[model samples]
Target: MANLAKIVYRPVGLVGGVVAGIVAGAIFKRVWKIVDREHDAPDALQAEYSWPKMLLAATLQGAIFAAVKAAIDRGGAKGFERATGEWPGS
Candidate 1:
């Protein structure tokens, strides 16, 4: 635990998490938007891109989830621990 603690405050995890979140949010947003559009739902996605808010929300949430998941999944891989490297846990 101590050995891996070095990266606890590192920007790598935060940046990575934000990136992942943004990607996931964007994908989900697109899917929902298309579905809503098909049914002519008033809750359809924005016609114009709201990069500022959308990206910020996505990145922020994504980063948090990514970081937590990473931390929990720490410790080398389950099976074949010695064979493959450990998962990125935080």
Candidate 2:
């Protein structure tokens, strides 16, 4: 049962990961627009922005991405459990 659940969840997890990434990107873009009005968030290679601001942006983006991924993963797991009568995770 555990192996079967793992096999069934692989594709679900893949789709969930993709969807989470899209959602996180959209959210980060919107948030960056609001937080930094005239400029986009800094990438790792960019040095135009102050270190504090860049770090803050990176931290916020990471937090948002993690939260979105967790939510999507949990929802997918719950849905799988509902359909299969078995939890995907132990």
Candidate 3:
């Protein structure tokens, strides 16, 4: 249903995208560290302890989450149509 699709599905997609993106970004970061040089593991604050990067990730993820949440909060596709006078599907 359009209602369900817009409300539950779309927001989930948006949130999911944000989550996936953040996760990918985290993977791309050098936030982890190795406890010992001989080991390939990370140290307490060596590998992934960047405050700036963490803040950036949080902001980015929060923004994306907010965007989708706002859309769903406003109302689903029907509400969108009411305001815009345009339905996506015929």
Best-matching candidate per lDDT:
2
lDDT of each model, Cα atoms only?
0.47, 0.93, 0.49
Question: RMSD to native for every prediction?
Answer: 8.3, 0.8, 9.3
Tens digit of per-residue lDDT, candidate 2, span 1-90:
988999989999999999999999999999999999999998877878888888989998999999999999999999999999988886
lDDT tens readout by residue for model 1, 3-90: 4543442354456456666665565566545644542212226655455645554565556556655643342223213433433332
- In model 3, where is the ten-residue run with the lowest total lDDT? 30-39
Q: What is the lDDT of residue 16 in candidate 1?
A: 49
Q: What is the lDDT of candidate 1?
A: 0.47
Per-residue lDDT over 1-90 for candidate 3, one digit per residue giving the tens place of the 0 to 100 score = 555445544554555566656654454343222222332333236655466645554565566556654554445445656755654333
Ten contiguous residues with the weakest lDDT in model 2: 42-51
TM-scores vs. true structure, each candidate: 0.36, 0.95, 0.34
Off by over 4 Å in 3: 1-47, 77-90
Superior by lDDT: candidate 1 or candidate 2: 2
